[model samples]
Target: MQPQSADGASRDPTKVRRNLTYDQCYYHPAPLTRVHGQDVRTRSVRRQARIARREAALPSSRTAVSTPASSGFLGSTSYLSVFRETPRLSKAPDRSLCDEFEQWRTKLEYAAARVVRLASAIPFYLEQIRWYYDKGRFTVIPAPIVLDSLSQTVAHMESHPWNVTGNWASIYSDLMAATKSPLEISPNTSARQFNSLFTGPHLRFEFIGFIFAMAGLSVQGRFPGRQSLELGNGEKMDTDAFTTEMVLACHHCIEVCKQNSHVNDLTIWMRYMHILLATEVLGEPSERVYSLFGDLTSDIYAMGLHHQPSDHVPFFLAETRKRMLAVSHRTDKNLSTAMGRPPRLPHRYCDEALPLDLPDESLFEEKDSLERFLQRLDDGGWNRDGKFYPATLMRMRHILSNLREQVLELSLGRSTHPNYTKDILATYKFSQTIFNRIPSRYMYTSSCWKEMDAIECLARMIVRLEHLFSVLQLQRIRCQENSEATSDLLDTCLEVLSIVVDLTGQYNIHEIKKQFAWIYLLKPRSEVIRTLSFLVSWVRNTVTEAQPSVMVGACLELNNVIFKLLDDALNYRPPLGSGQEDARLRSVDTGQSFEISIQGTRGDLPSDVFNIGLASGESLSWLDDLDFMQTSSGLSLM
Candidate 1:
C-alpha cells in the first residue's frame, strides 16, 4: 500500500504510520518541552513585580504585623522548642495577651452570627415586599410588627452567637496538655473538635432562612400600581418600595459580606441573591433585571481581578447556568447566569430543511387565498366558495405533489464529519415522530383540515429523512478512509431507520413500503438500493436476535411489511417471462445475495439466498395463514 501524508498525498504507508501526524501539525517534541521558553522567565519576573506592588499597597498595620508561630489558632510552640536560640515569652507573661485576643475573637464570632441571621431574613422580607408590590394591597398588619420581628431576630442572633472561638480555644488547650511533641497537634483532632461545635445542621438552617428572605423580596416586587406606605417616622418613599429596598439592602449586604472570613456566609449570600434575581427573570423581562446581570458579571470579574485570565467569569457563568437550569428554585444569580446565554435553536435532523430565505410573496399569496377559502367553508357552505374551495384543494395537492421534488433537491451528497451522519440520524428520528403522530384515518378520507395537517407533517418528515439519507451516502463514501468508525456510524443510521419503520405502525406501513419501493427502483439516482438492502438485513438480523416470546409476532409483521414492498416491486416490473425483462428479473433470486467473506484464506464463502419475492405456496402458508398480510400498501395505512 502507498504511504500517505497528513494532507493525503501518497507516500510510504509505513512512514505515514510511524509519523502519526495529529491535527495537521508535525512534531518531534520531547516531554517537558516548553512552547515559549524565553517568555517563561519574563513572565516570572513580571509576576514577582506585581506581588511587590501588591505588598507595597498594603496598609501599615498589616505590613508591620508579622505573627509568631504561637499566633496561629494553636498556642505558640516556639517557647517550648528545645533548639531555639532566643528565649520565648513565658505563659504567665502572655496570659494577658491571650485574654485580649480571646475577647476580640468572641466579638468577631458574635458579629458573624448576627450577619448570618440578618442575611437569612433578607429572603423572607424580599418576598413580603414582592407580595405587597404585586397585590396592590398592603397587609393590614402594621409595619411596626415587621420591624419588631426583624429587630427581635437580630437580637436573638446576638444572644445566641456561635461560641466557635471558645471551642477552638478549649480544643487548643486540651491538645497542648495531651500532646508530647511540638508538631503533634493533629489536623484530624482539630477538625473533629470543630465539627463537634458547628455541625452542618446549623449551616443548613441559616442558609435556608437567607434564601427564603431573598425570594420573598423578589416575589414582593411583581405587582404594578401598588401603593407605597410611610413608616412610623413619616418618611414617604416615592420608589417601588419593595424592589428599591431589596436592591439597596442587597448592595449593603454585599459590601459587608466582603469582610466575611467564613466561606459559608459568603456562599449563602451569593446563593440568596442568585435565587432572587432568577425569580425576577422568569415572570418578565425588565431593564432593571439587565442591571442585575451587569452587577453579577462585575462581581465575578472583580473576584478574579488578581487571578489569571483562566478565571474568566463568563466561562463559569456558562457552566453554572447549565447546572443551575437542571435544578429548581435556584438563586437570582444562578438564574441570571442561566439567562445570560442565548437560547439554543431547536434540533435539526436533516440538511434539506427550508432555506434561510423567507418564503416568497407568492407562497404568502397562496396562503392568504387558502385561508380565505377555509373561512368561506367555515362561514357559508362549501357551495358558496366553490372555486375558492377547489382552488385551495389544488394548492394543497400541489404542496403534497412536490414532496419528492423537494427531497431530491435537498440531498447532501457525502460528508466526512461525524456530525453529518449524526445529524442525518437525528433528522430521521424527529421526522418519524411527526409522521407517526399524523392520524391514519385522515390520510385518505379526512376533511381538508385533516388532510392538510397530515400532508404538512408528511412533507416535513420526508424532507428530514431526505437529509438523513444524504448524510448516510456521504458516510458510506468516507468509510474507505476510516472504515472502522464510519461503518459503526452507518450501522447507527440503519438502526434509526429501523426504528422509523416500527413507529410507522400499521397505517403507515403501506405508504412507507411504496416510498421504499420507489427509492429502490430509482437505484443510484436516489439512495434506494443501498437503503433497501440495509433495511432487509436489519429486519432479518433483528428477528434472529429477538427473544422467543416476541420473535414470532415481530417476524410476522416484518415479513408482512417486506412482502408489501415485494408486491409493489412485482406490480412495477413482473417476472422474466411476464413480458418485461426488468419485471421478471425483479421477481427472481438472481439480483442480490447475502454472503460472508473470510480474510487471509482461499476458501469458498458461505452464501445465503436473499430473495425478496414470494416463495412457493407451502412456504407462504405459514405467513399468510397467520393473517399478517391484510393491510394495503398506501398512505391511509400510515
Candidate 2:
C-alpha cells in the first residue's frame, strides 16, 4: 500500500529523510579523534589505560631477568596468582533502539523491524545480491537477471572510458545534465540523455515508494533556510548530501527485497520471469549492523568456530567453517580499528589453514571434478589464469588479517614496559614481507579489469587499497627517527587519498563500493581515513632531533587535503558547539568541545582550525595550507 502522486506513482520515498542511522552515510566523513565517543584528549588516556590493563594481566618484568641464585627454587610461578574464574564488574548492555523505541507499537512494530534484519532471505553480502526485481511488486531485479544491464550500459558508452583514456563526463555530455528517465534505453543515447540517466535519480525506495521519489528528485530537496539542495555542476555525483541520502534509500530498498515483503511463492515465480524483461538495485540504514557484528563474533567463540573442526567433518562443511573463521578474524581487526578497541580473535591463538581456493561449482560437482580443480591450481593453490573463486579472496584476506592483528597488537602494546619488543625494524620488515607475498594474480589494475567480471575486479581493487592502507597505518606507529618509512610510502598514501576522491566521482565503482561501504578499506570510515590523514602528525609528534622527514614538505598540505577530501566525501560539517544538536542521532561531543555563540555558527573561535606552533624557528612556508575553512555542504551522514 503506497501513497500516490498526481501521476499515480507512489510518494513514501520521502522516508529517506528519516531513519538516517539504519544505513551507512556516504556524505559526511566520520569524526576523527572522537569516533569511540571519547573526548579528543582521552585517546591517549584510553591507549595508556589499555596498555596498563595488559601489563597488569601479565607477570612482572622481574620474571624475565631472574638471576641464577634467584632462579634456584624460585620459579616464575612463585609470584603468580592462582588461575580462577571470578565475577567482575560489567557495563550496561547496548541497546539498538533509542530509549524511545522501548515503547514498541504492539509486536507489529518489532515484527516489521525483525523482518528486515533476520526474516529477509536476501543477503547484504557481495557474493549474492537482490535477484528478484519487478515493476510494481518489487523494484529490485529478478532472480534470473545477471550482468546484462551492466553490459548494455557498457555498450552505450564510447569505448574510451575515463579510467583509461577518458572520463565519464568528458566522453559523455549528459552525465550531469539528465532531467528525465527514458521511456526506453538506447545503445546510442545522446550525451545529455545518457548523463541524465547516468547521474540522475534511479528508483532507490521499494516498489511504490521508489517509483515516486525517482520522479521527484538527482535528489533535489529543500533545506532549513529554504536553501536549494544543489547537485554539483559536472559529471561528478559526489555530493555528500545526495550520495549519503541515496545510500540510505538503497539500504531500505534492499531490506524490502530481502524481507520478501510480498511473502508468497507464486509472485516470486512470476517476478523471476519478468527479470527476463528488466531490473534495478540498493540497504536498511543501521549502526545496529556493527552492533550485530559484536554479537556474531561473541557467539563465534561461544560456538568454538574459532578452532578447526573435527577431522571427521566433510570437506565442504569444514571449509565453510574455516572460511567463516578467516572472514570474522579480518572483520574483527577492521571493527577494532574504527572503534578503538582490541581485536577479539587474536591470530596468535587461532590454529587453522585458509580455505582452499576453489569455485562453488567445483565443490558441488562430482568427486573427480573437485580433484581436477585442485590439481590445476597454482603452487600457492590460486586458481589458474587469474580466475576468481570465492575462496581466492578469502585466502588472501586470512593471510592479511593475520598480519594486521600483529600490527594492531604492537600499536596498542605497552611500549614503555620492559618486556615490550624494542626491535621495531623487524616488525616493519615482517609487514613488508607479508604484503609482498600476496598472490601475484590478486594484484589489481583498472586496465586489466577487462579480463574479469565486475565482482572480481572490485575485489582486487579493494584488497590492494587495503594493503596500501594497512602499510600507511603501520607507518603511523612505527615511522619514527630510526624506523621511518621511505618517500614511496608517502606516495602510496597520496595515491590512496586521490583514488578515494576519484572513486566518489566515478559512477560504476562508486555504486558497488557504496553497497558495502562500512567494511571495505577503499570505502573506509572516518577512523581509517584519519590514519592516513594523521601520518604527518605522527611524523611531527615524534620527539627527535633527527633530520626532518623528506615527507614533511608534502605533509604540509596533507592535513587540509585529507580534511577537505573527507569533508566533501561525507558532507561532514556538523554543528559547532557541544550544546548544539546534531542532525545525526549520535551524541559524541562529535563536533568537539567548541564554545559557540547564540547563533548556530562559530563566533568565539576563529575560522582557523588547527593552531600549530613549531619549536624551532623554521620558515613555515605552507602555513596557509592549514586553513580549515568550512564548506556550505549540509550536515547528514552515518
Candidate 3:
C-alpha cells in the first residue's frame, strides 16, 4: 500500500522507503540533541542491563526486540520480535490513518498532562493557604503580593497547557507513523514500551490521580474560606463564581481533544467533570462544562444508536463517568448524586477531612488566591457580553439524563454488572456530606455558588425526596380518613407537589431569573411567598369566622405547605435577587464600638451578637423574632 503524507496526499510512488526498525527509529535524529537525549540514552542502557540481569524476571519465550548498536552506542532500538512482519491488513492500508491518529493522541496527552501538572501544584498551594489562615493572616496578606504570585502561576500554567498539548500531539503522530511502516505491533505483544505509549507509564497514571486531587483542592481553598468571610459579614448566601477561567479551561481541554479527535478525549472530559461537579457544589457552576457534558451525553447516545465503530472511546467515556460518580460519592454521600436517589450522608463539604481541626485551611487558601484574582476583574474592566449566562439547571438536566442512562445500563445488566440502586445511593449520600458544610442562610452569595453546586443540588434533591415521600404519606393518610381529613391531606399533598413540580421544571428558567440562589431558583420567590402568605391569611380568616370542615381541611393543607416552604426558605441561602441584606451582622453603636478577631471560626456569632447589641437594646428582641418558629407562632401560626 502507498503511504500518505501529513496532508493526506499520496507519497511519491517512485521513491524507495527505508525499512526502519524500532532501534533505527530513535537514531533518525542523528546525534540526538534533545536536552535530555544523552541522559535518556544512558538510562536506556541501564534499563536494558537490568533486564538482562533479571532475565528470570522476563517471561519465557515472549517476543523481545534485538537492540543493535551503531558506532559503539546503544539506543532505544527495542521492539517485540513477534511483530517482525507488517501488521496483517484486513483492509488496505490507509497510511494517513496513522497520521490522523498520531495527531489526535499527541493533543490528548498534552491536555491530560496539563491536568496532571496542575495536580502537582495543588498540595503546595493548599498548604500555603491553610498556614496563613491558621495564623489569622489570610485576608491580612497584601493583595498585591497575592496577585503577583497568582499572575506568575497562571501564566506558567497557560504557557505549558499548549506545550503539553503539543507533546501529546507529537507522540500520537509518531505512533501512527510507526503503524504505517513495516514495523508491525501485535495486539497482545508483551512490549512494556508499547504499553507505555497507550496506557501511559506509572507516572502518567499517577498524574491522573493527581488531577483528581488538584481539582478537589481548587475549591477547597476558596469555598469554606469565602463562606466564612460572608458569614462574618452577615451575608447569608455565597455568590457563584463559576468564572470564565474555569469555563475556558474546560472548553480548551474538551475542544482541543475534540478538534484533534483524541482517543482519550472522553476520559479527560469525564475527569474534568469531577472538578466541575466539585466547583458546582461549592456554588459556582460552569456553563461550558455543563454544555459540553450535554453534548457528550448526546454523543454517547448517538454512538450507541449508530453502532459507531469508536467502541473504545465510548467505553472510556462510560468508565470515566463511572469514576466521576465514584469520586463525587466519596466527596459527599448526602450530596445529591447525578442519579436521582436518596442521599446516604447528610453533608458533603467540611474541613474535618483535612489535617485535624483544619476547617479554616481550605477557606483561607481560597480567599487568598481568589481575592487576588478578583482584583484583576478591573484590569480589563467589566463589559456585559450581551448574552445570558445560561442557567445551571439546563446543564443539570443533561447530566441527570446521562446518569439515568448509566443507572439503566447497570440495572438491566446490559453493560457491566453492579448494583444500580446501591451506586445511586452512594453518590447521593456522598453529595449530602458535602452540602452539610455550606453555611445556611444568606451568609454565602450567589457569586460563590459554584463552591456548593453539588451541595445545593443535594439539598434541593433532599427537599424533593422529602416532599415526595411526605406527599405519598399524605395521600395514604387521606385515603384512611374521613372526608374532612382526606380533603385536608390531599390539598397539602398537592401544594407540596406544586412546589416540587415548579422546582423540577426549571429546565428553561427565564434569562433574568437564572442567576438566582438555589432557593429562589426553585421558583419565583416572590410568587411562592405571595401564595404562601395568601394561604396563611386564608387559614387565619377561617379560624376567625365560621367555615365548613372542607375549609378546615384546606387550612391543614395550607399549614403543611407553609411548613415545607419555610423549611426550604429558612434553611437555604436566600436567592440571588431576593434583595434581602443578610440580616446577620455586627453593628457599631453610634457612640460606641468594639473590636473582635475572626480567628477563622465558621459562624455568625461575633457579627450577630455584636451587631444586634449595638443597633439597639431592642435589637436583641428583634433577633428573637427572626427565628422561624417565633415568626410563625404569633397570631398567624398557619
Candidate 4:
C-alpha cells in the first residue's frame, strides 16, 4: 500500500519510506549504522529500520508524536511509525537542569521577601530613632552592616525575573536604578573616555542611592504603618520596638560611608544630608555638625566644585555640581550665622554661578537646550518663567548669605565704612523684591500641596525674619553712634519679633510637633526663640509705661507664644541675667529709673532665665541662648 500525499495522490510505499528516511537523516543527521547492526539494504532502508526499532522499544503511552504539518496515509500503521520515530529525534531534558531552575526560583522568592520586609520596617525604625534622639540617648551604630544586608538582598532579586508589586515597589525600583553601575570596560580604553563614562555615573548613583534611602526612611517615619494598614492585616506595630529598630537603622545610614577615604561629590552630598538630619532633627550639637561641615567644605574645594563649572562638563552634571556648591554655601552661611563661626565657604571661594531656575524635567530633557536657555537669561537672577521652589530657596539663601556677612561685620564693630548703611538697605530692598516676585504657588497659603505647605511657609518666614534681623542689627550698630537711630532700630526689632509670634500662632501645637520631626524647622525655631527673647529683654528695659500699652501688649503676646512653642522637650528659656540687665540699662543716667519684669506667673518663666547671665563674666548677647552659643567652641563675632 502507498501513502496518500496532501493532493490525494497515491505514492509507492517503498519510495515514500525511502524519502522519509532520507529526510530524517538530513534533518536529524545521526549515524544510523552505529545504532543498528550493519545490513545489506540501502542507507535509507537501514535508517528507517533503526528509527522503527527505537520507537517500538518505547512504551505504548509515548508512541504518539505531534507535527506541524500532515502528510497522511489513512489507517496506515507505517505512516504512524514514522511520526512516532520523529519523537526520538530531539534531545531530552536533563533532571539536573530542572532542579537548578527550581533552586533559582526559590532563592529569588526568598530574596525578594527579605528586601520587602526590611524596606517595610524602615518607617518603624525611623520613629524609634527619633524617640531616642528626643531623649538625648542617641547612640551610633554601624551603618555598613544594614546596608550590606540590603545590598545582598537586592543582588539576589536582580538575579531572577520576579514581579515586585506594592506601593514601595516604585521607590525600590528608583533605588535599584540609582545604584546600578555600568558594565566594566577593557583596561585598554583611553583615560579620558573611561573617566567620562564611569566617574559621573558611579558618583551620581551613590549620591542618588543615599538620597533614596534617606527619603525612604523619612517617608516611613512620616507615614508609619500606612502600607500595612492598607494591607488590611489589622496588625499594629508596637511603637517602642519599631522606634528602636528605626534608630539603629538611621545610625547605620548616617555612618555607613564614613570610613571611605576617597572623598567625592557623592560622599559630600551624602554627608550634607546626614548632617542636616542629625543636627536639625536629632538635635546633635552644633560643634559636631560644624566639624562635619568643615570636612564637606574641604571636599568641595578638593573637587573644584566651588569654581564655575567648565563648558567641557556635561550641562546637567555641571548644573548639579553648581547646585551642590550652592547648597554647601547656604549650609555654611546659615550654620556660621547660627553658631557665630566664620563661614568656611567665603564669597571669594564661591564663584560658581547659581543654579538655573528651571524645572527638573526641562533640564533633564536636554542639557544643551537648558544651557542655551540659561545663556539667554544671563543676568544671574531668578528665572520668572516657572515656579521653581528650589531656585527660590537658593535665591533666598543667597540673600541670607549676604545678611550673614553684614550681621557679622556689624557684630564685630567693623561696619565703619561710609556706605555700610546704604549697602545694608540695598540688600534688604533686593530681598524684598525677590520675596514679592515669588509666585503665589510657592506660598503656604496658596500652594496646592498642603502637606508641604507648612514647611514652605516656614522657610519663607525664616528668610524674611533673617532679612529683618539683618536690618535691625545694622540699625542697632548705627544707634550706638547716633542716638537718633534708636527709634528706627527699636521699630525694626519689634517688627521682627512680631512676625515670629504671628507665624508661630498660625500652627497649633500638633502641627508644630509634626514640623519638629523635619530638619527645616530647626533653625527657624531657634531663631524665633532667640529673637523673641531679645525683644522681651529689650522691651522690659527700654519701654517704661504706667500701664501696659501697644509695645507692652506686643511683648506679652510674644512671651505667650514663645512659652507655648518651646514648652515641649526643647525647654527653651528666655535669657535673663544681670549682665543683660546691665547692657540694656548701661546708657541710662543715674536720674533715670524703670521697672522690668515678666507679666506671667513663676511657672511661665524658664528656670534658666534667672540663672542666665548671672555669672560676673556673662554679658548681654543677641540670640545667645541658641544651642550653638552654649558650646565653648563657638566663634566670637563680637
Best by TM-score: 4
lDDT per residue for candidate 4 within 595-614, as digits (tens), equals: 22322222222223222331
- Total residue pair clashes for candidate 1: 40
Better of 3 and 4 by lDDT: 4
Off by over 4 Å in 1: 1-223, 230-239, 258-262, 265-275, 278-325, 328-421, 424-638
Better of 1 and 2 by TM-score: 2
The list of candidate 4 runs beyond 4 A from truth reads 1-213, 216-261, 367-378, 412-458, 501-505, 508-513, 516-638
Off by over 4 Å in 3: 1-244, 263-275, 278-290, 299-638
TM-score per candidate: 0.22, 0.43, 0.27, 0.45
Candidate 3 lDDT tens digits, 106-224: 54433333343233343344343444333322121222223333334345444543222124333334324432232223333322332233221112232233233233334433444
Ranking by TM-score: 4, 2, 3, 1
C-alpha RMSD for every candidate = 31.5, 22.9, 25.4, 29.6
Model 1 per-residue lDDT tens digits across residues 230-345: 32221323213333333433433443443433333223334435435433321212333334444544443344321223222222222222222212111221222223222111
Assess each prediction's global lDDT (C-alpha) against the native. Answer: 0.32, 0.39, 0.31, 0.43
Better of 1 and 4 by TM-score: 4
Model 2 TM-score, all chains together: 0.43
lDDT at position 86, candidate 3? 22
* Each model's total of backbone clashes: 40, 27, 77, 5
Report residue 113 deviation for candidate 4 (angstroms). Answer: 19
**What is candidate 2's local distance difference test score?**
0.39
